[model samples]
Target: MLTIKRVETVVSMHQQLEQVPGCGRDCLGNCCIPGAKLPLYTFGIKQTLGSNKRAHTSSDDHCVPGDVGDFNDYEADDSPQENYFLDELLLAQWEDRMVRGLFRYDVTACETKMLPGEYGFIAQLNEGRHLQKRPTEFRVDQVLQPFDPKKFNFTKVGQEEILFQFGPSEDNVSEFYEKAPVLSSPNVVAINVSPIEYGHVLLVPRVLDRLPQRIDQDSFLLALYMAAEANNPYFRLGYNSLGAFATINHLHFQAYYLAAPFPIERAPTTRVSYGRKKGGVKVYELSKFPVRGLVFEMCNSLEDLSVAVANACVYLQNNNIPYNVLITDRGSRVFVLPQCFAERQARGEVDQEILDTQVNPAVWEISGHIVLKQRKDYDLATEEYAWKLLAEVSLSAERFEEVKAECLKAAFEGPPSDSMAQPPALPNGGSYNLLEKEQAVLIKSNIHKANSMDGVVPNVGEVGVEG
Candidate 1:
C-alpha cells in the first residue's frame, strides 16, 4: 500500500542508514534493490546484436540489424538443458507466491470454460479481478508518451512480487543462481497482483531505467529470451501499446500459462512472400479470423525474428497507431495486430453491449481468451458473440493493407521486389495471391488446425495480461 512518494522517502532514509543491502519494505525501489538478493536465471544466445545505445538515425531507429545475411542458414539449437529446470522453477515459485496470498484474489477459484463453436474461444468468470480503483487511464489517441515518474510503475511493486531476474549469460551455457545480488538495472519478472490467469506475471526489462511502454530492440529481445528459456508452448507472452488499452505507460510484457491453444494460434495463416528466397524473417497474414493480424515467424535467428517484429511495433507507435502483439509458439511465432478498438470506442462505434461488458479486448482477448467481469457475460459467451465483438477491433481492409505494406517495408528494410508483383504458385499446385487488390501475397501452405476438445478446457496453470 506504499505510494511512490513514500517509497522515495524511505529510500532516502535507508541511504542515510549506511547504505544497507535492503530495507524491510522489500520493494523494487532504490531503497531495497541496491544489494538485494533474488534468484537469477541466465540464458545463452548463439549470436549477439548491435550496441544498446539508443539511436535516432532514420534507418536504424527501429534497431534492425544492418545485415541479416545467411541468418536462415544458421542451424537451430535445441532448447537449453537448463530450460527444463527453469520452466519447473518458474511454475514452482509462482505457485509458492499464490500460497502466500500475494495476488488480489484466488484466480484458481474463478470459473472458466471454453465456449462451443468452431473457434472454441475460452471464457473466464473472474469478478474478483475488478480493481477497487479503476485502472488509471492514459491518453488513448497517442501511442508514444514520456515516462511520468508520478504515475504508477513496476518500480513501486514489492520485491516479494518478483519471481526472478532473467538475462543472458557470459557464455553459451545456461546457468542459474540460488541467490544473486540484484543488477543495477535488472530485468525483473514479477506477479500481476490483479491476475487474469494462472502464473500471470509481468516481465519488466531494465526496471530501473523506467522505460516508457515502447518496444525497442533490446527489451523485445529480452522478452524473446524469456519465452525461449521457458520453452513451453503454452507459456505465451503479450504486449499492449499505450493507446491499445495499456493503462500504465511502463515498459513491460504480460505472460501466463494456459493449457489450451488460443483460437488465433489455430487460425489459418497464409505466407506473404515478397519473392525472397528462404532466409531472414517470414511474415504471414491471418486468414478467417475475427481480427486481421500479421504473424512473424523465425526463418533465421531469434534476433532476426525479434527485430522484424520490433520494427513493426516501431512503425505502429511512430505513426500513433495503437497495436497489440502476442508472442506465442515458444517464441518462434509472433502476432502483430494493428487494432482500432480504442479508437472505435472513442468514436462511439463500439456496440453498447460490448461497452457494457467493460472488456478492454487487449492482447489476451484479441487472441481468443475473453476475461469476463460479470457472470452474465461468461454464461452467455459464445463463438459468434466473441467473433462479432473482436471484429470491431480490426482495421478496415484498405487501412490494414496500407499498414501491412508499410510494416513489410519496415520489416524487410524495403518494399518487396517488383518481380513479386504477381502471385506465386506453390509446389503443391496451389496458387497464392492477395485477397483483394494484391495488397498481400498469400500462400496456402503451413496451415494450423484448431485443437479438438470435448468440454471445458482445464485450467491447470496461470497466464496473464498487462495494461
Candidate 2:
C-alpha cells in the first residue's frame, strides 16, 4: 500500500531525477507510467524481497539478484506466440476486463482537489480543468459502421504523418517527415515520442528516458475522472492485463467517444450498467492487491469525483491490474488511441500465420483483441491448424491453466522450454561463428543500449519488427 512515506520518497526521487541531464543519443523519453508493477517487480528482484527473486536479464545473464523466481515472464524476448502459438492463433477468446493505461491515469485525487492557485508540478496539469464537470452528452451525426476485418486496412503512414519512433536518434527521418495536420500532436510538440502502439497519439517526450508510460497514480486517476466528467459521452473506461492483448506488449489504451446505448444494453443485453456494476458489485473484494474506490454517479462535484477516483483505486488493488478507471453518468462510450498508431495497426494485416508461425503483421491490436504472432515453429501448412489447436486449449480452463503452469516453469535465463523437442540450436548454414565473429568485431553483453535502431528496422532481408 502507498503511504505518505512511500509517496514522499517517490516525490523526492522524482525531483532528484529531474535534475539529471538528458541522454538523447542513447535514450528515449519513456516516462514511467503510474503503477509500474514491472519496475517495482524489478526493485523487488534487486532487493530479493519477493518469495522468488531469481530473474535473468537476458538469456545468458543469470540472476545475481538471488534469481527472481519468475524472470522470463517480464524478459525482453518473452513472446506469447513462442509458447502458446497454436492456442492464441486459433481464435480462442473469452470475455475479459479492460483498463486504460496512461490515458486514464491522467486522473488523480489531488488533481480533482486542485484549487485556483494550488500551484505545483501536478497543478500544471489543470490546464483543462474547466472541461471536467457533470458528464455531458456528445451528439454527433456520423453514422456508426460496424468494424469489419475486411474494410479494416491497417497500413503505415510515413512522411505524410510524423512517425512516433522510440529511437535513439532519427534526424534524417524527421527531416523528411512533415508535421501532420492534427491539433496538439506530439510530433508538433516534440519529435521523440514513444512508438509503443501502431496508432500512437501522444508526442514523445524530449527528455529521453525521463517520462514512462507509468505515471503519477493519484493525479492520473483524477485526470480520468475529470475527463469523464467533461462534456463527453462515455460511461465507463477499462484496461487489459500485460501480454493478454496484442497491445499488452507495449503499454497503450484504446480510446473512443461513448455513443448512445446500443441494442445490446437495451433489451436482450440489459445486463451492463452504465454507471455501476449491478448488485452493488459485492463491494468487489480481493486479497492480492490494495484498493481504493468511490462511486460518483450520486454527486457530480469534484470532491465526489476525487473520492470516487480514490475509491476506484481499490479496484486496481482488488483486480491486481494496472489501470486508469472512471465512471461518468453518460450512457455512451469513448475511444482514444495512439495518434500515429496506424503504422502499428498496419502490421496487423497479415492475419494468417506464416510458414514459420509469425504474427499477422497487420491490424495487430484493438479493443480486447490480440493478434497472435506466428513464428518459427508454426509452419504455414499447419499454421491454421496450429491456431485452432491453441484456441481450443485457451478456451478450456484446464488446458489454459496447464499452459500457464508450464509457462511459469523457466525463468528468462533458466532452462529453455520444458516441452522443447530439441535445444534451440544456432542457425545452420554457418550463420556465423560466434567466437570468430566476436573476435573480428568486439561484442559485449547488454540487454539495453544495444543496436536499438538496427533492431527496429528491417535488416538486409530480415523482416523487422517495424519494417
Candidate 3:
C-alpha cells in the first residue's frame, strides 16, 4: 500500500528540500523557474559518429556562449576529436550535485557483486530503493496511463536535483553555459533519489510537457543522444514501461555508470531479417539468455535505430503490453524486452516463493543486474537462481513469437495508422486489449535460435513479484 504521501516524498521530497535559490519556492514548477538558473550543455547537431569534427571548447576566447563557430575553421580535421560532451562533464556536474547533498542515499556505498556463474550475473543489495506499498494512483496493469498531475511527477522535483539542461545547439558546435535560464520545455537530467548505482540519474525529456510514460520519437532520440554524448560503454540507459516496474507514470529513462558489462550484453544474438534494404537498422534476438528479448543495432545512424526501437515501444504501449528497454553500447544497441511479470502477478499466477523475495525485475534486472531487497537472496544468489528469476519475466514462446512478428513489423514498417493515436483504456476496463487488431504474419525465416552456451540450461523459468 504505497501511500500518496510516501510516494510524494520519494519523488518530490518537497519537505526535505530547501528553498529555491532565486525563486524562494522549492519546486521546478513554472512559478519557480521564471528566473532560476542551471548549468546547460548544448550539443552540436552536425556532429555525427565517426566524423572527423574538431572538438569545440568553452575556453575558445573568441567564441562566446551560444555562438556557433565558423565551419571553415574545423576543415583541417587533424584527428577525429572527441565531442565536447564527454563523461567528465556529466560526471563533474553529477558529483557537484552529490556534494550538495541532493541524493537520498549514497548508491556508491551499496553492496554490489557479481554472482559466480557462466554469465556472471550482477547483484546489488539496494534496500534503500525497496518500497513495499504500491503507488496509489498507479494502475500497474496499464502501460499508457494518463499523467495524473495530482500524483507525483518530475515537475514537482526540486531544481537542485537537476544536473543540466541538455539540448542541441543553434549551430554546428557544442557549447556549455555556467548559468543559463531554464527553458520552458527543456530536456533535463535529474538525480534519482533512490539511486541503484553510482551516477544514477533520470533523463526527463521536456519536463514541462508532462507527457505520460510512453515513448515518443523525439524523446527517444534525446535519450540516444545522451548515451552518445557520454561516449562511455559503461554508462547505459534503461526504460521501464508503466507496468514494467516503472512506479511513476511520468516520462523518464534511468541511467547509471556501471564499469562492468551486463550479462545481457555478453549474450549472443542471431540477426532477424525484416526484408529491409541493407545498411539501415538490424534486428536481432537474444540467445542463451534467461529473458527473451529483441536487440536493435544501428547500421546507419542513431535516428534509424531510435525510430525502430521507438516504434516497437509505441506498439507495445498501444497493445497494453509491459516491456523494458536497454540502451547500451553508447545508444548504438538497444534491447526491447516484452515482459509479462506484472500481468502474471496481477492474476496470482506468479510463484509464492518468488513473490516472497519481492524482486521487481525491471530493465536492469532483466538485463542480468538483479537488485535484491533481501540479504538472504543476495547471499544465496546463483546463476541457476538468476536464470530462473528472469525466465519468469519473459513472454512464453508462443506469445513471444506473436509479439516478435508484430514488433519487427512495427520497427521496420512503422506502427499502424489506426492504433497510432489510440489511448490506453482505464484500469476498470482491464489492461489487456481484448479487441484483436490485424496481426502481422510471423516470418519463420526471420528468426533463428542461436546455440545455447555450455552449462546453461535450456528450460524456461517463470517467476515474478515486486522488487
Please name the candidate that would achieve the greatest TM-score relative to the true structure: 3
Top lDDT hit: 3
Ordering by lDDT: 3, 1, 2
Write down the TM-score of every candidate. 0.77, 0.24, 0.79
Candidate 3 has an lDDT of 0.71
lDDT (Cα, tens digit) per residue for candidate 2, span 1-467 = 11111112110112222333342111222222121111000001111111111111322222112122332432334332121211111111100000112111122211211111111000112222123211212111111112222221111111111222211111111111111112111111111111222112322221111221222223233234322322222222333222122221212222222222211111111111232332222111111111111122222233333333333333222222233232322211111111111222345532243323332211112221123322223122232342332232121344323322322221111223242222123345322111233211211121122222222222111110110
User: Native-vs-model 2 lDDT?
Assistant: 0.21
Residues 1-467 of candidate 1 have per-residue lDDT tens digits of 11111112322111232434555555688876776777666666643221111111112111222222322211133323234545766777777776666666677777888887877688888887664313755688988878887778777777777888777765545555656667656788887777787778889987877778888766788888778777665678999998888878889999988766678877877778752443477678898998998988765577888777887787777788899999975576789999999889889999998889888889999999998888888888889889988998999999999999888876767323441212123345532211111111111121121233222122233343221
Whose TM-score is higher: candidate 1's or candidate 2's?
1
Clashes of each: 7, 104, 8
Which whole-number lDDT from 0 to 100 does residue 3 have in model 2? 12
What is candidate 3's lDDT per residue for 1-467, written digit by digit as tens? 11112334455544444554544446778767766767666666557455422122212121111211232332223444365354666666666665556665556656777777777688888776775323546878888888899898888887777887777654545556656766656678888777777668899987876778998777888888888777655678999998899988888999987656678877767767773454378777887888889988776788888888998899999999999999876667788999999888889988887888889899999988889988898888888888988888989989999999999888888899877733344344532211112100111122122233233222211111112
lDDT of each: 0.69, 0.21, 0.71
Model 3 TM-score (2 dp): 0.79
Which residue ranges in model 1 land beyond 4 Å of their true spot? 1-24, 47-82, 132-134, 414-467
Better of 1 and 3 by TM-score: 3
Ranking by TM-score: 3, 1, 2
